[model samples]
Target: MAEAAAITWALELAVIEMFEHICIESDAKVYVNALAATIDDCLWKIRALISMSLKLSS
Candidate 1:
């Protein structure tokens, strides 16, 4: 869950910095898969973070 939050925070920072290109990698498959999963299908704990990450990445 923390990993997902960090990912979202990093994305927010990147956007604030006006970065045109960036790469994010994580070894936490749980968080990675949670982000890839649909919001409804994701665990409740990380759902909001995943949604935020999606919006930021888009």
Candidate 2:
């Protein structure tokens, strides 16, 4: 959840800054894998954050 929150926050910042491209690096392999999956497959705890991150990233 914490990792997801950090990613979400970073993505939010990138969106606010109008960045054309961004790269995210994390040591949390499990969370990274979760984020790579569809929202429906996301863990319940980080689902909302992941959704928001995906939206901001796109």
Q: Clashes per prediction?
A: 0, 0
**Model 2 Cα lDDT, one tens digit per residue, 1-58:** 7878888899998998999998899998867887789889978888888789888988
Give per-residue lDDT, candidate 2, residue 44: 87
State the lDDT of candidate 1 residue by residue for 1-58, as single tens digits.
7788789999999999989888989987877887777789888888888888888988
Note the residue pairs that clash in candidate 2.
none
TM-score for predicted model 1 compared with the true structure: 0.86
Off by over 4 Å in 2: none
Worst 10 residues of 2 by lDDT: 28-37
lDDT against the true structure, per candidate, is 0.86, 0.85
Q: Give the per-residue Cα lDDT of candidate 1 at 22.
A: 88
Clashing pairs in 1: none
